[model samples]
Target: MSPKSLCFTVLVAVFSVLASRVVINPTPQVLKYVVDFGLTISSSPSIVAMFIPFDFDDLRRHHKNPDKGKPVSVCEDFPPNFPPPETNTTLTLCVDRNGCCNFTTVQAAVDAVPNLSIKRTVIWINSGIYYEKVIVPKTKPNITFQGQGYTSTAIAWNDTALSANGTFFSGSVQVFSTNFIAKNISFMNVAPIPHPGDVGAQAVAIRIAGDQAAFWGCGFFGAQDTLHDDRGRHYFKDCYIQGSIDFIFGNGKSLYEGCQLLSMANPVAPGSKSINGAVTAHGRASADENSGFAFVNCSVGGTGRIWLGRAWRPFSRVVFALTSMTDIIAPEGWNDFNDPTRDQSIFYGEYNCTGAGANMSGRAAYVQRLNDTQASVFLNTSYIDGDQWLLSYDT
Candidate 1:
């Protein structure tokens, strides 16, 4: 055979072997690169090949996105350089006759907090009646407003629904856009009333609109509309909430653990009118399926006669689990909100509830006694299963 023909034969043989093999290489950056070929010998020999290149930068960007999976950790610790915890030292914020804290008001201290501080910052409020409306915005979390005492460190305001040109649903201490911790503080509404029939006159002592807000060992005092536990998920432990009419009414999902529900008598009553509006008008519309008002190991006591609860609107859902009720509770346990048709849509239940008021013999047939498994859902703060956001609370 000629030398050129021999070279051609050798090249064909080498190509035939290469077609059946695959090659993989790893770059110094730990990316995998692969090359593969498949051979067909029909007519003249032909080969099909493919190449795959891994891009580390594209993968890194995807992992860093918050909506995607958890962010990649560049450092050993997940969150590098997290802020240190705040010291428990007390910072006295005195609101004097001119409403200033060391020449600055209480609002000034709240606004000055560094964002996302892990430390527990306590605002030690001195003994004086503060008249300004206070708001704890969401930017400043883990803040504790500690009062000298419930009475001594009182925050008093007279912003009624009528005077403020708002509804009882509007809060006096409007806790919006903030996760707050309040303890040993008294939130009072000093609103005067002319008559009991004045339906529009409403005063909210503390309206909590922030999610995950907590109140510990605090007293909320007002006559008509008080302690408006408004929208969002909130926890109130070891607190006293007092009001006369449908006071504790709101759309928020709340867990009142070991709290006191007090009822102030209609100031105009001359010992003649025996019946007062319901103590709790849960007002949780059905549109809010996960929204509810839960009372766990709470006590319901009042000066005048009051029903344990009433459906403030159609399709309200409320549950009182393991709560102690005083004789002030009406025999019926729940009111119809003056609409008999609401009986079909209202969801009012009691689970392991004890006391003279829990007697179901006289309770409306619509009122149910939830089974153990059913009541467990309401006991915990899992508005949605597996989320466990409520567990983040300092119960």
Candidate 2:
């Protein structure tokens, strides 16, 4: 008999006996599937089958209640007994425009806290879109912004570099405090998407200049400069960020773990040479600055042809370790932004990255394929000084 017929017979006989025990094991971990040949028998196999491990528990839970959103975990930045009932020790302020909370606007709720207070304060925002520019000044420490969920709670605004505020100051939410934490929230910039013809459209969703800050389950959306990790040491986990040009640009020492970096298409212009934009523009100006961006095990994909990064400053530094990139990434993974001199200074590298886009064969000459030892430096939390703060919060 033919190989295809033999395999089909074998599968039928195997499944027929296994089906008898289905009542005992309702959900099996193994998933079996068959593949058909597309080419000639010599070039391609007539029958190929494989078994994959499927997560039945998660699948069942999701099917049970698809509408229910994931619950927000308690802030790791604060202690278990943090925010005590005492006004001096703790405060929980709610902001709901529909009269379900203390204040209607987010700023009002934030302003209610005492400046330079040592106590922990949690601002719980209800599900709604608040179109306002929110700022957490340097004075406020140990403050947490808790939202209903990323899709349910959003702080959005429209401001571009061409606006009166300028690129550096045009942020929907700007945080300059220390020991701050945000969870299940979204920071959005409603500025128009950038086009090749556009001149300077750098809008920021969130400008985080805070030290020892952590964001979890958050979303940042914009076109250019979506997230400005400007100055400080920070950590981001399970977050989604989408943009077109130099989206996640900054000088902060940051560790992005298990996050998503999505690319959007750039509008076509009369004389545009490239249709896609660069994902990062790290600004580590000098070698002395202890700042860089490390993305570990992150998912990088989306529309448009894009580069992993471009040198925003002379000593720009960035790394991607064990990340999964899509075909959208350009073969020349890193760009010098037409500045040949920057090619000598950028510390761009990748380690054990997988995917068609992660291939280093066609990458720029300056881009380094890190070895096991070199990759270890950027893969851990220590890259962002997280050893000092992250452990404390996590405990």
Candidate 3:
């Protein structure tokens, strides 16, 4: 183990001892919508998770089914599962709405971090809805947004494509710096939901243009273009993403494991669904772009007849492995965006997936028939070079 890992292991042992002595009694009101964890390190979900991610089933055991409901006003404070900095001199910023911490707004706390600092700066956000558009600039790298819980803490805005000047800038939470980490927080674009064929209604909950970004137990909410996984390598584990048309779109080389992809597509009669929505719209312009989306052991469910993904760009690439899909998916598993030429280049495939929607009888022709060897390349964190920056965890 690296020195950092050795220190974290020691800290975990010490913290476990201290945690066993405490008693937790959350208020009744806060327990109803859990559908999850107190989250990381009291106020550092992203930090604790990266260093000590548990088993997938352990992560899934407490989660409520996405179709059942979302989290309401529920969150509980706790001791750090693993606090960083053996010394009290380490850098950490606290954001609380009532001014109980270093700052009130998330952006202000982000601005407080030193630019070009090699050490990671964590911003602990208290449980509350922050109505603001936050950005992590390129100059400041290694910033982490650790929240109380996915259901209790949120950053919200209502910028539509036209309102924000462009769809790319409409995200409520935008990350442009490298090595960004967010855990247990929900990013929401609360603009009005749009019709299936509507235009200018693209509202992005989060736009991650940063390299080496990782999100754990997070939430993303919107109607269209919900998550702009813009560019770079990202890992999202056990996240809840809700949206309609092209809900999860972008060019990022991302791996989404143990995630719940809840589709918010309208519930219409099967035959009446003419202008329907799609779950993903990967925009890989060239075969050599080195960007695509790989979803492993995820769950896809919700209303509307949705396409697994469409060839948003000519050379778009995507894969779903060991995932469970509902009948909400269109019979034709994928679309070529009405471009016959794209059918020659796009790579859309599924392997070992289950559920009615996973049936391949009506799938598009261009889908790659992936074998075990080919599927292994995109099966784990290795696809995104995660070992370099991410904490080494058994999961």
Using TM-score as the measure, which candidate wins? 3
> Clashing pairs in model 1?
85-119, 86-119, 101-104, 137-178, 138-177, 138-178
Better model by TM-score: candidate 1 vs candidate 2: 2
**TM-score, each model?**
0.68, 0.76, 0.78
RMSD of each: 29.9, 15.5, 12.9
Q: Write the per-residue lDDT of candidate 1 for residues 1-395, one digit (tens) a residue.
A: 64324433433343334323423232111111122233333432222111112122322443476576667643222222322233464233333333323423457667766676655565656544455677777777756776644533556565667668886444557776545778767786655531356756777778877777777777777666677767777878777777677778777778888877776553224434356756677766676456778888887775667777788878887889998887667777888887999999988989998887777788888998899998988885464232544333342
Reference-based lDDT, residue 30, model 2: 20
Indicate the TM-score of model 2. Answer: 0.76
Global lDDT of each candidate: 0.63, 0.75, 0.77
Error of model 3, residue 311, in angstroms: 0.9
Better of 2 and 3 by lDDT: 3
Q: Write the per-residue lDDT of candidate 3 for residues 73-163, one digit (tens) a residue.
A: 2112223443444234346788876555578899998898888877768788876667778999998898888887775577877788977
Could you give candidate 2's per-residue lDDT for residues 208-291 as a string of tens digits? 998989998888878788899998999998887877789999899999998888877543443444647888999999989989
> Candidate 1: where are CA atoms >4 Å away?
1-104, 114-121, 138-142, 168-170, 193-195, 266-274, 380-395
Error of 3 at 201 (Å): 1.1
